[model samples]
Target: MSSSLSTVLLIARREYLERVRTKGFLIATLLIPAVMGALTWGSATLASRAKTTSHVAVVASDTVFAHDLKQQLGSSAQDAMQVDLVEPTTASRARLDEQLQDKHSTLAGYLWVTSPATAGALPHFTYKARSAGDISTKTALEDAISAVLLRERLSERGLSHAEIDQLTEKVTVDTSASGNTKAAFIAAYTMFFLMYMVIMLYAMNTARSIIEEKTSRVFEVMLATIKPEQMLAGKILGVGGVGLTQVGIWMGAAYAYSTFGIMASGGHVLIGLTQVLYFIAYFLFAFFLYSSIAAALGAMTNSEQELQQLNMFLVMPLAFCMVMVFAIIREPNSRLAEIVSLIPFCSPLLMNFRLSLTQVPAWQVGLSFVLMTLTIAVILWISARIYRVGILMYGKKPSLPEILRWLKYS
Candidate 1:
């Protein structure tokens, strides 16, 4: 027994160091933060660039209405959806055509609103464009025109500005059993993405490493010194440790950045440091549980083909739980969500997402932890049993029944 543990630990240390010291590991650790920063900066930069407006020639008898329409449709829209309403008379069109010819005309096209109408209503028009703008642009312009027309209509009637303001403002109702807070919302989302990402990273990595070892004949050499159970356990532990390291790096960077930035503008959500401990707890258990299954699948295949086919069972449950993440958060206490959460395979993800949005009963949380621990133990035994015999098995992969038989072979 002492020898067994020594072998497992030695194998684990070797595997961990081999992976951790790789060029890939260093590149990933650096690139992930850099890419995250780049994305955030890029999004902000794109958002900051003011949209240029297209100039439309407004040949209108109602000059006051045209001016109001132009004012309502601000110049900012031009950056994405440019619209310029110039008072281009027939004489001006001859010159405007030359400007249009350069193909660099800031003018997207002209909307000739000919007929007279009050503000806020759509005017009859002919618009010239190279191509149609996207729906969002169209929708924004529609909203502006609708707002202008609605106000004008309200004025034409006997309604005051205050009445229109009261009518136009949108209403939202907040309802929650717990206090509705940003922290609660953030907790739920954080739980979801963390589980999703960590599980997938370690699970797929385990499978890939197993396949790589099998293809390269490294497993045969490694198998001589270590038992299959030790090897399997060590591999899962090692890969999971690597994933945890990356996660730690990310969390540390985020916390450090947040600490400095809090002086600039404090964040709204507040999750305690203790919650991070729970995240780690759930993460470790989930990674080991899933990586064992992934490793078993990896042992069952000589190539990627059969490996992928078997992974669908694993992926499907995760995908389903993720799909209902919002539902889980909305009704964390619902009978169905609760039942789903108790399912060992789904609990880590489903419960975490719900935990954020709802205050789960302590009994339920304790019960879930107990139940999932047992389930993971059971799963590990099964996977280890399969690995013991299946690891050395070659040729065509066995059927599900055959695989079950291996576990039950005694």
Candidate 2:
């Protein structure tokens, strides 16, 4: 092997080992998944234990209307609600109000209905709950009362029970038939955000690593033996490998957990083999692309503060991509999604997100990869020129004009 290639590999190996052997690396690798699992379990547990059962009383002037409304609420309750009929009397209402104020009372609230005295006149409804924020319960009550009123009107018109039942039956759309299942959405959202987070984190770490080495003057000594381009190449490879390794470990654990029926039984989408492969491919493309920019930013800045100030430039594109994520996921084949997914800066995330929701055209996918590769090559070339000069500079950040001149230094 050529001495330059050997030097690059050696530096890469050194960079990889230095990070992987750190206590922080080990702790972070294990702790992130543990924290994520704890959060998932905690959220699921809280949702399962949330107070879904709503206890309420129905009061109306008409006894038959009251009974029908009670029956409607009961049929749609799904065992998560209780309904009771109360006479529409001043005394009864005062007693119900007392129940609502009682801290130990399970009564969520009461619904009061005033049936119109004349035909074609509108009925009035007043729902009083202890908490005004219980929108779900309020919406349920509204729907049930409307159905009851509709049924009563139909009955008055002499419609049979069967006809009323047929008319009022709810129709549900099958999202799975259109390939828009909840599981798929959850999977796409999870994977897209996961990629966003991991890429940003590792790319920033690369920048921070460069800043540390540059500050400590480690590069001045290494420069005697390794070229700037080789050093930059080595750092990207090493840090990226570390990121890939951690991701692989997490994916492996996820796959194993899915096999045990715990995650699978919950109806959560499992990361299939194809998804995993695509994830790795996109991660590499994304990490290298962002890390190249990060490396350039690190080399140009003299201090961590300077790097922080300039960091927004690197973050803005990713943030824009994140803003477009919902739109892309909702309509993967839309013209906007299609166009954005092909932009080199956005492709790594947008394209992968598109893949998760729907099958992207092979040409678009191929073109995206091609564009990203070319962009990476261009950025790496620019970063190498900057790194060659900026690695040894100190005490001040370079201006844009100075940076352009650095690029011209060959």
Candidate 3:
């Protein structure tokens, strides 16, 4: 191998090893999956416990109406509600309220129904609950009352029970035809954020690492043997490799969780070989692009504090992508989404998001990769010029004009 190629590889190996061996790396790799698992398990457990039957009372002046509403509520599987028929009287309401206030009482709440005083007028409903924000229970009550009212109206018109049942039957939509948009949404949302996080983190780490070495004058020694371009190449490779390794471990853990039914049960769209490959590809594109910029910044800045001030400019593009997330997910194939996904700065995240939710055209995908490659090449070239001159210079931070001149001098 050429000495330069060997030198770059050697530096890369050193960079990779130095980070991979750190306790922070190990903790970070393990902590994310552990936290995710805990959250998943906790959510499932809470949902299961929430299914405990809600005991409530339906109060109406008419005994038959109250009974019918209670019966309708009982038929709903999701609500898991047990209802009581209470006469609509001042004393009865007071008793129900007292029961709700009693900690040991099973009565969660009560629904009051008032029949209209005139013909063709709507009935009034007032729900009093221990928790005013129990929207699910309130929604279930509304549905049950609406169904019962419909039945009553149909009965008054002299329709038979069988005919009324046929007319009022509920219709369910089959989402299987659309490949479960919800699952696609979850997968897309999860993977997009994951890409954003790792790319931002590791890319910034590259800059910080460079600044640390530069500040300590380690570059002065390394420069004697290694070219700045080689050093920059090595740092990007090594830091990116560490990031990829951590991501690989995360993907593996996700696959295991999915496979064993610990998460993403019932054919969830979480993990696949195609998605993995896409993730790795986009990750590299984003990492190399941003890390190149970070290295340039690091070489120019003298202190971490200065890096922090300038870093917001770097973060703005990613932040913009994040702001567009809901819009892209809502319509992955929209003109806006398509246009933004093609921009090299936005492509890595938006493209992956689009891919997860829908089938992107192969040409668009190929074109994005091509554009990103060209952009990375240009950025690396520019950053190398800046880095070559900036790495050795230590003093006040350079102005934009000085930085521009560094490019010419290099």
Candidate 4:
């Protein structure tokens, strides 16, 4: 490579290293995962501890099996819950209202399960809210009530315990599908998040760098030393290179973490080394396309105030890409999803979304990359042309037509 090109790369490497080495970066790198780990541990401990205590509120109805039912609930709840049985008490209408309103009530809803008249067939389930769970809460309640009713019925029919056991057989749901659903889910969603974050990060930096150079009049000096295209190339390459370096470092750290976890658990580990190549390829094309546009826009503006007006042109598309995150997850193989995934402007976002949800074909992936590269080449040429002369002009940002004319003239 030429010395100018080398200088650009060196400058980029320094910029990337400078950001990565900062205190903020170091704190964030360590803190986020640590906080997440703490939350996971804390939640598990709380859940394990919660099941041992049952809060029961008995209303104005008395029955033989109330304490027994409460006991069953406590036992079934697994942490060996101690039942806090609140006995029924009579009060004035206003006093009853006041008691119900009290927040300190140790009540998991009122148990009217043993109403003498209604306790024949199906057991009563009246609580403050809906049932707590699918298996342990809902099923447990039904099964307990059913056992009691079955015992009563068997006593009436003169049947034995062995006959009751024979009636309760086995039921199961065996399922199978020819798909890597979990991998698709991870890959496609990861792609969307990766694209969304990286694009926004690099694109904003590109614009800011352009604005800085333009405001400082460094572009003029830089222009004399090198072509605008080369300057644009170097800046994009440098910033983009820095971004890739950070990604590489993060990936390495992630892999190390994964390896450690796998060894601890005695499990196989595959850190997905191949995906890095695809990541770099797509990122470079996306950067060149986006950075050049931002640079050209930066050249046209003399001030930050002027740039703000032009910001919407880039911002809206990114917002659309973000909105599609759900759409991609919901229906990965939709026509709209497929079309968007193929489009050069939308590919980075949509492709990532599709990547996470489905097993994309090689042809589709290859074709999208080719089209994206072509689009970037065209955009870079246009941006370079406009930037060549736009850097020289001052005041009154050019209209689209005016910019086109300057690009032609430049």
Decoy 3 TM-score against native: 0.93
The predicted structure with the larger lDDT, 2 or 3, is 3
lDDT of each residue in 1-410, candidate 1, tens digit only: 99899888887888899999999998877776566446445644664563534444444556766665666666323333434556747866666666656677655445556663665445675555434764444445556556767777887798998998788775666533344354356435755776787788779889888888888878799888877888988888788889888867755654443344321122432333444555666777778778888888888787888887888857887998878776676677998888887777887787666665656777777777888889778878888888777777888888889998898876
**Looking at model 1, which ten-residue stretch has the lowest summed lDDT?**
261-270
lDDT of 3 by residue, 94-182 (tens): 89989998999988789898988997677899899889887778878887888888999999999999999999877877765545555
Candidate 4 per-residue lDDT, tens place, 17-129, comes to 76667786567556644543454356446744755343544442444455555555666534343444544454532343454467875443344443556545554555442
TM-score on alpha carbons, each prediction: 0.78, 0.89, 0.93, 0.73
Q: State which candidate has the highest lDDT.
A: 3
Q: Which stretches of candidate 2 lie over 4 Å from their true place?
A: 2-6, 21-28, 31-52, 77-79, 178-180, 253-270
Span of ten consecutive residues with least summed lDDT in model 3:
261-270
The global Cα lDDT (0 to 1) of model 2 is 0.83
lDDT at residue 26 of model 2 (Cα atoms): 96
Model 3, residue 5: displacement in angstroms? Answer: 2.6
In angstroms, the error of model 3 at 319 is: 2.3
